[model samples]
Target chain A: MVWNEKAECMSREEKEKLQIKLLKEAIEKAYNNVPFYKKRFDEAGVGPEDLQSLEDIEKFPFTTKADLRETYPFGMFAVPEDEIVEIHSTSGTTGKPTVSGYTKKDLDIWAEVTARAIDMAGGTKKDRIQNCYGYGLFTGGLGIHHGGYKLGATVIPISAGNTKRQIEIMKDFQSTILTCTPSYALYLAESIEKEGISIEELGLKSGIFGAEMWTEEMRDELENRLGITAVNIYGLTELMGPGVANECMVKKGLHIADDHFYPEIIDSKTKETLPEGEKGELVLTTLTREGMPVIRFRTKDITSLNYDKCDCGRTTVRMSRITGRTDDMLKVRGVIVFPSQIERAILKIEGLTPNYQIIVTRPEYLDEIEVQVEATPSLFSDEMKEMEAIERKIANKIHKEIGLRVNVSLVESESLPRSEGKAVRVIDKRNFD
Target chain B: MKIQQISVFIENKEGRLKKAIDVLSKAGINIRALSIADTSKFGILRLIVSDNKKAKEALESNKFVVKENDVLVVEIPDHPDGLNTILGYLDDDKINVEYIYAFVSNKTDEAIVVMKLENIEEGMKALKEHNAKILTLEDIKNL
Candidate 1:
């Protein structure tokens, strides 16, 4: 198995001290290497000496999504293009996509980190893993694939779609482990039941699902349906994809590969680091990336940190399941509403489904929120009055939960578009420009 | 005879159509026939309704992005040649049909063709010259 000497047995105090050392090293690297970072640092009138302790970390300017946008394709890479072995990017709904790169050493380290994550999730070399995440520029598939291979598992690269074929490969290979998004996993389980394939008949045992937000209720449902344990994996294209963290068999929270990537929670507004267990924005600093070394990269994902030791015997700190995104938070009428909160409200409704849209429009001056929910087949009926009543009920529930009144529209099931990649959650038409 | 034609701009998202329907229903308007012209991001819902003024007011008040426009409505035979005859008339004059939609009237044994034209006045004249019936606003509402 791929293992790092420094991470495996390091004490908590040693890890913390090591992180401070690395943060200073990363700041100096940015100051001396990248022109963009240099300009920002010079303009801020800050030097390496200013970063004496973690308290001074707030002195650095917080990087925004706009900064990533300003750089565009590969402008932020600290190393030369010739040194970069691979390039990955996230798609753009508004403008050009944010690009990232990896050197050969970086890829190797990523594979090692992923392997460690797989081990944390209770996978052994004896298990045959079926990976359904998409590859190419997308990180999910290749990230998990490299990790599974490193762990010496027979990896089946069934990268997204064709659920039937995925099932066939799983059964034929007697695959014991699966790695894909939670949505796709649910879809696969539903398809298996529809096809009358018993879960017991397939030797599948465990799964690692990520790349989109899911709830605890969803995890329970998936576990019950797939007849296996499901673990949550976390990462982004900007931070080297799915291996930045993984949940242990305990499934309490995702364990961060804290040795390679330092994790900190920060107040989204003030950019101040919060104490552990306080809900805030996740900030990551890569200690040992080669191609594009990042220093204090602000990942807009909102979650808290857990330093409690796990029963699995790993000393790495864990992160709670992502509640939502700092950017994804919808500010309407001076109220901060997350789409996930609406999703939670909708999921609690007996006949409502997960497919929905949060539309924010500026008809007058203030922003108005409208939730268009898709009614499951069970909720659809011949009676028009019943459907209207259901809509009213849903609207009332949303109002009660979020403390904001919203217009609710009950759309037919499958009426909402399905995404093959990241699901588009919010549609803001408030003239953001 | 006055008929109201309304165009609504919509995105390909859930609840949009239902919201439109809700707005129209609240205004006590009945849609005679409707067509959706869709691209990826936005869709235009064009409707011929019994209460056009009410429908337009309700849509605008509810903040639905909409526009009002006029298109020539022509009555045609129910048979296949009904459309070919109209196209044949326009083709001879070198006038092109940009887009079109239709609703067949069961009792009347006729269909209505709502056509957008390159030249509206000339296109209507060419159709009238061919002895085809150009539907008035009253003709559409009665159906």
Candidate 2:
């Protein structure tokens, strides 16, 4: 099922030799075309010739999401605007969205990597892919779309939402491969169940879920519910969308497409490279991207790399599931809690994409956390006994996640928003002023 | 016989009850009996209205978390011992009355009691043997 044996399964010695060559070419491309990278390279006292080995990547300045934003529209593109063929962007909830421009060559590379991902997920030409990721500007839909096209699989371009129709297409089209956010997959499963459609009624064999943090427990839930092998796909718009790394059938860890993008782990604060298996921020360099050659971009995602050979037979280094981001971790009553932990706790409860938001407020001398869970129509009850039991159940799950007692309130379902990458569900109302 | 009742969730805050009442009023749902079980955290407002479907649709359209459950509406004398008498029969049968709320009928001297019993089947048998007058949805609408 490996798409390209030479690239995916090459020997480590040969790989590193190839990496050194591609790294040098990418550095020279970035320095020559991008004034931002040139200034960064000059300020850091590092030049293209200095990148002699993979280890020399340490000398290069780390490009960040902030740095990418500073470049704005076309500042990061190594190719001229006429040559750039496509653009995909992050949701940019906090500030201006980071734009990723791709040349025809860059897109072909995206197709190959994603095709490798789909192949890794047990997809092939005979498979029909029901791509549920949004098709617009987000890389998710089009990424899977292009991969399916390259793999010669029939791609159903049904984008996100319209739950009823999603299930209808899932049944009528007899889709065998599914792709979307992990939360949305859960939501679709619950919706299908509500429609009284059995797993035997559909043809789903595997799924590619990503775009947010998810847990192994949630993975089990999705696999069991949809009766499909759920694989995790990892990428950001800063990188070339969702083909950077993906989990193979062995499900050990996500295999980073080592030949295309180089992966590194470093202390987020100190900027020092950590040894393999030591957890830190994930730093990536687009070694082969032509339109935009990112040099050591600090992704801010917390994970570790494993160079050990995978049972799936790909020599590419695999990274553990993203636990959290350094920038999004929250401190509640001095105890560090990631929104992913809360999401992990929330997933324990039934109904797709549990609608719960953590409300942090300091009423007295202490900070208190109250999680507001929406009482959806499927879970709501007319009796207080049943409704309160649901609340207490969510509260107990939250307590187990973070060893602290917090309030649980069942609010009207309308107040809570449906998260699809429904970013920022935590509300920090505590004021320091 | 059991009748359907609408239960609406109300947070412990000002003007929530008024908003819920306004929804039903604008829908022109004539409420037969109404009661509020209050806690410091929140309250549950239970009601027997002229139309259960209309009232629920109205409340839900206004963004209220409304639910429907079955409860018994019984007719008794408008005296203290009337409720005591009905309770003694259920107590003899060991059926627990989870909650009970009463409304005085304008058409008669009898008081209507809405009771939610944990052992509903047992409570129904006991009440029937004791000759308790259980109201139907139509009887509730008339009351």
Candidate 3:
């Protein structure tokens, strides 16, 4: 069920050769058309002609989110305004969002990579795709929709929210493939039971989940609850939506579309590309994008690259699951801790709900963190001693997980806020800005 | 008799107890007996109100989590040794009281206390053997 088998199954040498040629064109296009890339390239004294081999990419300047933010609203488009057909943007927390434009051919390539993503999730033309990723302004919805259509599957553009309607349509349409964020998938799994709908009633073989960071424990929960193979799909609005990489059934790591998106791991602080298997920040270059060809864009997401061939028969380089973001990595009492690590610890223990919030504050000279986890009905006790014991158990578990002690508070049931999209779990009051 | 008490789960935030009280007050329900057990994180505010149904609805409408628990309601002498005398009966009967809170009954010169015992049925039996007067829901409504 491999989509674009020739491109996806190419040998390492062939793929590298293709990537080198595409990189030259992308660099030349970015230099010739986009003034931002041109000025930045000129200042670095690196021209398109300087790109002789793949190794020459190291000499080029790295583009960042701030750089993209500077060019808001059509400033980064490499193609003519009329040539650009589609546009998607991320919800920028700081006032204005970063926009991405795509030409018709660029849309075709988006569909192609998403098609490969759907194929990686074991979806085919016979499969019915119930896409709940969200449709407008965000790349998740339409990006996966394009892939479903390209894969020739029945794409149910159900969009997001409307939990009841989502389930009703899922059962009626007999959708075989589910696509949404991993958190949303988990919500649906829980909702299915609340609605009295058994897992066997709907035909869901696999789910392509991404758009937020989720742990392996969550994946296991989704897989068990939905009775399907839960796979991870990685993509950002800047990098052609959610078709950038996908996890095959092998469940090891996500295989990046090597020829389309040239992937590299780099030390975020040093800005130098790290060798294979070394964990660092991910930097991606859109080798074949026409509308907005990004040149070595620094994706603040933290992950590692595995160049080894996968058992799923794809030679595309795979990236380990994103562990933490360099920006969100918390330094508490000189100890580095990721919310994901704390989350892993919380989920590992029984009688604890997934809804939790981390509050970091600087009291005097020391930084303190309080992890507040919602107490489900089963976890709640009327006695103070029993409830305090629950809090202590969670705190000890977190200390063991992150190597840093934190105050654990067992808040009332359903006290924390629930998000339909990305959940904001951290409230940093350290005032470091 | 076993009286139904409403246990409200509240965060240890300022005005939380007042918020629950406000809800019950706005509903025109009279609170009979109340006790709060809390840690630094959260508190469980237990209440015996004129209308358990109405009080629960009011607090829950305000998005408070409420649990219905059973506890023995008995009348004791309204004196310095009243609470101690009731506990002596439980001790002599080998019964365990988890928590006990008292509210003066308007109908008499006695205090009606809510006893959250480890075994409600056994507590009622022991209190009955000691000739302690236990109040029912109807008696609580009248008071």
Candidate closest to the true structure, highest TM-score: 3
- Model 3 TM-score? 0.87
TM-score of each: 0.70, 0.86, 0.87
After aligning candidate 1 to the native by TM-score, how far in Å is the CA of A269 from where it should be?
Answer: 1.9
State which docking tier applies to candidate 2.
acceptable
Each model's chain A TM-score? 0.89, 0.93, 0.97
Candidate 1, overall lDDT?
0.79
Distance from true location, Cα of B116 in model 2, Å = 2.6
Error of 3 at A318 (Å): 1.0
What is the DockQ of the complex in model 3? 0.37
Q: Judged by lDDT relative to the true structure, which candidate is superior, 1 or 3?
A: 3
TM-score preference between candidates 2 and 3, better one: 3
Global lDDT scores for all candidate models: 0.79, 0.87, 0.88
Q: Which candidate order results from sorting by lDDT in descending order?
A: 3, 2, 1
lDDT of 2 at B15: 91
lDDT of 3 by residue, A244-326 (tens): 99999999999998888999999998998899999999999999999999989999999999988889788889999999999
